[model samples]
Target: MKKWREYERLVSALTAEEYDKEYTVIPNARIKGFISQRKRQLDVLVEYRFNSDLNRRIIFDAKDRKRPVDIKEVEAFEGLMKDVGARRGFLICSNGYTKSALRRAQEHIVIKLLSSDQIDDISIGSWDMCRSDSCGDGLIMWDLTPGIIIDGTVYIQATGKCDSCGKFHIWCWSCGNRICIDYESELQCSCKGPWFWLTSIEPDCDEIGEQYESHYLILVLGNGNYHIMDRRPI
Candidate 1:
């Protein structure tokens, strides 16, 4: 349990430090009063800072328990919310909470019950380029393998087939690579380089880890470079 709490603290500290441009997080802060005179040590303290005038405390309690938390646990967390004047309180438990506990939290707008599974799903991963034409330069082809490292980052690629066009597409699990299957047949890509054609995409989400897949349209926009365009997923 101590090790789990330490891990949670480490994760919280890393996240806060990484996103310091957007938020201000204070882990393990000791406070007194507001309701009780005893000093309360918060597991992780966070503040959502958007602008000069927008900021509020978001408190967290990391519990490394394996049993389902009961309604009484929810009530206790709510008490801390009222005492600390925090707009939100996250009770992150490892084994999840009971239905009655969730029902109890419904009455408190600031109280939220989150299991480790749910918290782990909270990711800030973003696409490099959302627009098809704005992908720009810095394009490179991958060997199409699980846990492939590009620029020192791990990436996983998967394949998919469109039902309407019967074309296969590839989706990278890490870097989000779009698979292409429009083999130019008798014509060349005009880039004067090897085709580097990609084929064989799987559809199952369990395969690629992403629900979306797209078709790529490779173009040669001068300078001996290839621009990959995509019909992205919505």
Candidate 2:
């Protein structure tokens, strides 16, 4: 576990430019606070900005345990992505993903599975060279809802408002669910209907009347307010 943390730290050190040029790291990354679901807190939340011309963003839920990634875990990550306005999402686990879990992730987001052996091979020197030098004194409360994560090589996710419905949505191509934003409560959608909470608005990357792309659009609603987040490029 310590080694995996070291690898993550090292990966975080590489700049977006360095990552793009060498495939070594992503940029503008940040560790997410504990995600509150119902009454529980998740393991880890990470966001990154990918070094792409389209400004791709991604978000992930990481667990440093030896157990296989599960379906519920992926669902939680999907919910988080919609809340944060991310285009893609991932579930990073220490032991790798299960076959069923992988299939489910493919339905909603891109999933990356890493073995303990693979974690051992990465170099740790990059982290030591890029440590931050300054610290400010204050209890900073960052709205994880609007921050991003860049893991040195790609954008984990981006948080913002949807272009069409002007609402915040989390677009997960894998789960086929679009999460709607609910500001009053952290919950993206509270609708009791199964698909009602999982539907999305029109995509922003292509013409509206033309063929719809294979991306999930999320519509967030709560406290009589509404908004949307389009996760597709076209």
Q: For residues 103-193, write the lDDT of model 2, one tens digit per residue.
A: 7776558766655676567554422111112322111111113222223332222233221122334433324334444422244323232
Worst 10 residues of 2 by lDDT: 135-144
TM-score of predicted structure 1: 0.42
Q: State in Å the error of residue 141, model 1.
A: 36
Which pairs clash in model 1? 159-201, 159-202, 160-201, 170-179
Tens digits of lDDT, candidate 1, 1-234: 245644455445444544443344444555443567555676665544322111255677777777877789888888887776566777766776788888887743333445666646554222111122323321221122334343465534433323223233445453444643543322232333233333322221212122322223333323445433222111
True lDDT of residue 190, candidate 1:
33
Q: How many clashes does the backbone of model 1 have?
A: 4
Off by over 4 Å in 2: 10-55, 129-234
Question: What's every prediction's RMSD, in angstroms?
Answer: 18.8, 16.8
Q: Which stretches of candidate 1 lie over 4 Å from their true place?
A: 10-22, 48-55, 107-234
Q: State the C-alpha lDDT per candidate.
A: 0.46, 0.38
